[model samples]
Target: MISVEEAKRLILENTHVLDPVEVNLEESLGLVLAEDITSPLDLPAFTNSAMDGYALRSYDTEGAHEGFPAFLRIMGIIKAGDTANYELKNGEAIKVMTGAPVPPGADAVVMVEHTEVQEETLVVKKEIKPGENIRYKGEEIRRGDVALLKGTVITPASIGFLTELNVKRVRVYRKPKISLVVTGEELLAPDEEPKPGKIRDTNSVTLKFALSREPTEVISVDRVRDRKSAIEEKVERALRESDVVVVTGGVSTGDYDYVREVLESLGVRSIFWKVLQKPGGPLFFGRKDLTTVFGLPGNPASTLVCFYEYVLPSIRIMLGKNNKFPVEVDALVSEEIRKKADNKTHFLRGYIQGDGKHLHVKLAGPQGSHMLRSFALSNCLIVVPPDVTYLAPGSPVKVHLLPEVFL
Candidate 1:
């Protein structure tokens, strides 16, 4: 068996990044930018009004107050998206709406609330400073500036920013196409009624939803029996079609376990057989050319844990993400916990409490590999290294908090 770090290193070393593709700006969210994006033109493009009021020379409004108001003739109304052809003279003002281009010679804007309309003229009651309430051209982003760097993951805010810059398309790493092969004869679909020895195939459902958060496209989901021939056929088909193949079950040492054998028969080079981790000790990873394969344990909890720790990181790396692992935090143990002294690391399901500054963690019920109930309530994994066997109350341990949004 290999250590968790070694397993991760091997998986990443074999994983290859997908080729970049040009996609529409609207569909580029959650993808990594392959090319550095430079602004073609300045943001706002031109000096515009930041307020829906009068645009005039700042010197004209000096000493103007409610008691002694400065009166100026309103040249015309300039709404947003309209050009301001008339320039502001010494004692002239233009009723400009927000986002309207600032007229030439206008140094500031006076909000409508501070002025009162008196017969066809505007009375500005407050003193205005130079360049106040004005959005200057190129102030936010200058032309030729690097708006977004390469390898940056696009988010909703990024989409808005690019849209404002009139960016129609972006070059980004293509999302990996994945195929899920769930093997088990006793496994029943979620909607089926329970049988004497049958159980719901929760691993497939859980994995499907979990993979949805990452930059992956789940091309197909196939459930095959424990027979080696059945597993071999599905695995071969998935390897040919998808960039990544996730196989749940038949990895551990069981009578029906045949995933490892089937993978070897189908020419998938085994990178590692097992990892030194508690829940997913029997995890397996392999590769065939550009296609990657993960043989997760049969147990539901073990499968999910292995996916989060290993498979998720591989997908992230393929997408050119900067950080591929779960967020680790130093947390205080709320109670005593014990583990049998062994060389393998233990990742116990845990619940986090308190504010992030002073974090506390408690074990979620049983930490068995098949305990899905406990996994449901867990928001983090309490990491206990191989060297430690016992943890007293208040002990500082590293907690791998589940990310709110996966890349």
Candidate 2:
């Protein structure tokens, strides 16, 4: 009967990060970085125009004022990709488009709209300052400097930046191959209508959906009976094929709870049997060679709690992350709530709200293990510790945030 904190500490201390592997930049999203990355060249590589305007030396417009117009000759034109071959001399300007490289000896630019292109001559309506519209080279990134550090998850914005740096291939942590298994005689899949004696076997499928939020590749899902030998065979097969194996049910003390027995039979080293947490209590963990096994509770809420708290962290490690995990916080209760205290901790579903100041929370739906509807609608968990009395309004309570969505 270890506390949830104790169980989490033990789990983290026992697990090890997986090895790294290189992958292409196209497939790097949501995958962790195996190592740091540095820019091979300057981000822009050369100086370019920030606007479509005339490129001229600042001295040309020194005496020009708003009332007194300055006139100069338009000698050449430069488009985005074209380099201004003719450098700007005094009283001379070049027509430059957006992103065109600024020619040497030019210190300022007057917008084309502000300048009248009178045949070969250009007239400026107002005076401009030195380096007014010039975009300096390497303004975004310098050459030989690290653009992105190692272990930075590549996001959409990061993809754009990396692409601009001409990085076609990326070195990222390899996604783990995972196997989800469910063992129960009374279980049926969601696609099939449940018979009188059979309930839906949602643990494996739902767990797969949860784990698939990242870049993990699910090898396959296997359904086995509660028999120790049957579960053992499937477990062994999955362990050989996957980097991690997730099993649902048969982890408790019931006569049918035989997953631990099967893991032991397969020569797995058991980490622990239970933790002090509601919804999920009988979480069985073990290590078999390099593959890890997690036996989650059968109930939907229990399975979800296990996935969020334990399984996600384990998957993160498999994906090669050191500190990437779910965020937790202490929220103020909106109303007083109480329940019969047990030896284990209690996790109640809830909703969070902010009123321009501190965040307040209210119960989401119900606190039943089989109540999938409530869990689905929930956005957070009100974590109640053992020996705690009723939670009053404004009472600070710990909470684990969920992805926000309310129907």
Error of 2 at 311 (Å): 0.8
lDDT of 2 by residue, 1-407 (tens): 78888777877876666677777787889777777778888867778778999998877787676678899988888899986677678889988888998888887878877788788998888788888888888988987788887778788888888888888888777888889888898987778899999998878777878877778999989888888788888888998998888898889999888888888888889888888778788998888888888899989889988888888887787676765456677789998889776866888888887787888888988789987888777788888888886998999998888644332
The lDDT, on a scale of 0 to 1, for candidate 2 is 0.82
Residue-level error in angstroms, candidate 2, position 295: 0.9
**Candidate 2 local lDDT, residue 273:** 80
Candidate 2, residue 374: the lDDT equals: 80
- lDDT accuracy of residue 70 in candidate 1: 89
TM-score of candidate 1 relative to the true fold:
0.94
Q: How large is the C-alpha RMSD of every model relative to the true structure?
A: 2.1, 2.4
Worst 10 residues of 1 by lDDT: 398-407
Q: By TM-score, who's the top model here?
A: 1
TM-scores for all predictions: 0.94, 0.92
